[model samples]
Target: MIEVKHLHKTFRIPAPHLSRWERIKAAVTGDGAEKTAVRDISFTVGPGEFVGYIGPNGAGKSTTIKMLTGILHPTSGEVRIDGMSPHKDRRRVVSRLGVVFGQRSQLWWDLPVRDSFDILCAMYRIDRQRQQRTLAELDGLLGLGEFADTPVRKLSLGQRMRADLAAALLHEPDILFLDEPTIGLDVIAKRNIRGLLSKVNRELGKTVLLTTHDMDDIEQLCDRVMVINHGSLAYDGTIGELRERIGLPTILRVSFEAAVSLDNATEPELGFTVAEANGCELTVHFNRQELPALEVLRRLERYGTAQDVHMEEPDFEEIIHKVY
Candidate 1:
């Protein structure tokens, strides 16, 4: 489990060079040119929970992760992993945690994948029998056997990623911090990694905090989502709740028994605006808050015999844009 309370991180950026008059002007105006990467954000994650931390570039997602993992100390506020401060109790806390950054590799570049696992075993002081069992489980779940003997430098992107994931769990850490673990991966590769993450959370009971730009990764893997913008928490809730909060227009495509005129397709009673219309079909967009879906269907029935009706909700990416 993880807990963060009123966390804040600020960086003092160098001010741009200015002329004598400009410098004097800036000094008089009281401009310090400071950047706040995280602004008093607070959240908690329980054991066996998978939470997605997402935001745009420079939105403080990585900064917050670094503070949580003890890589960077916060300017103020508190962070505790299982009631132990990460900075104060780093060794113990890290022993119970795993981290995988997609852009970086923890494996020794000159060594074989198997050798990296063995080194981790010794580093963590994992018993030989338990290490082997963990490796076997990882091989089964992540398919690391195919290239287990290959050097870290020789494996492809997907292979290297899977090997890194296996390495992170060799000691069976309690929490996993994943920063864009699926970046630059293809569709099939992404699916494999996501399936492995889901198994780790559900079957192994590991708490995971994932940060990524890919919406599909969040949709497929996370039960709860937290959004950050301008160094502040913008939204924190279930994906369904996020969708409702954004209030994206719902789209409905209706087919009729007879050709309907596009000119007469506007229906204020149903609270739907015509998006498109063809020979025997009309595509309309409406706010679900304005009219109930069932009522929209009832009104469509009056237009014609109603051959068919199909509705589509907004995609996760669209909802994220709405957040900003």
Candidate 2:
């Protein structure tokens, strides 16, 4: 439902003003240097696909989203939503999209949440029956009824976020653009937002392009991920594919019946590194692709009688750090 080709956005930084003479010289000579926010990035998101666009704070994730949504023009590229250019036909293209920026709100501050919804329905020309149905569904999924009648200014951050999400979806757009949608919420609130997003993506079949620093959100919701760094596409694939590409290590913790001497421990031809060791307990790090878990266990058996064993995948934060 979304396509971007050779996308690039450059912003000119303003020069510091010194004197009137210098200002005139700058006006004629163009003193500002250009910085590229997005650099020749290209990707396509299919219908009903949930994709995560991730990067560090200054990595151009939001800049790309803005270009895709027609909020900002690209320096030289093409962006299309459902085969129509968002730049050339913004109104038509945007009608099929719902966007939510975590730091901003579409709802009026002094009005009740329901009032905002009513106004949005009118603006979108949605019929009363459709608006009610949409709100009823939102209430069930988001638990918005708790603050539906409350003024937006009075609602808690979590409540207000939920309302904003509801507002985004009221028109039942074909696609959802979510940028840092779970930014400052508490654990429970973040979980709620993630759950709602998952439902909106999977069950409702909305094509979603989410830009977030929250790796948990990507791990939980996205079927595929696109990583951006230094204004360029760094990675694009499934989480598992990314882990293998980056050689993200899997950890195995083994507890022995008795204290084992490191000198006596038999190392296999394909050996693993000791991440941590204390008395009878040892933590081993190995790439599962290179040395299988079974082989690691077998190697451990020769060292000492095993008491217990546990294994874990690399955390999402570690994976993102590798991307950076």
Best candidate, TM-score-wise?
Answer: 2
Q: Give lDDT per model, in order.
A: 0.90, 0.90
What is the TM-score of candidate 2? 0.95
**Stretch of 10 with least lDDT, candidate 1:** 261-270
Error of 2 at 15 (Å): 0.8
Report the lDDT tens digits of candidate 1 across residue range 1-324.
899999999976446787777767767775658789999999999999899999999999999999999999999999999999999999999998899999999999989999999998999999999998999999899998899889999998899999989888999999999999999999999998899999999998999999999999999999999999999999999998898888888999989999886544554555778788788898878888778878888777756778888999888999999897
Q: Which residue segments of model 1 deviate by more than 4 Å?
A: 16-32, 262-264
Candidate 2 residue lDDT tens string, 64-178:
9888889899999899899999889988887899999999999999999999999999989999998899989888888998888999999988898899999999999999999
Off by over 4 Å in 2: 18-31, 265-270
Q: After superposition, how far is residue 111 of candidate 2 from its true place, in Å?
A: 0.5
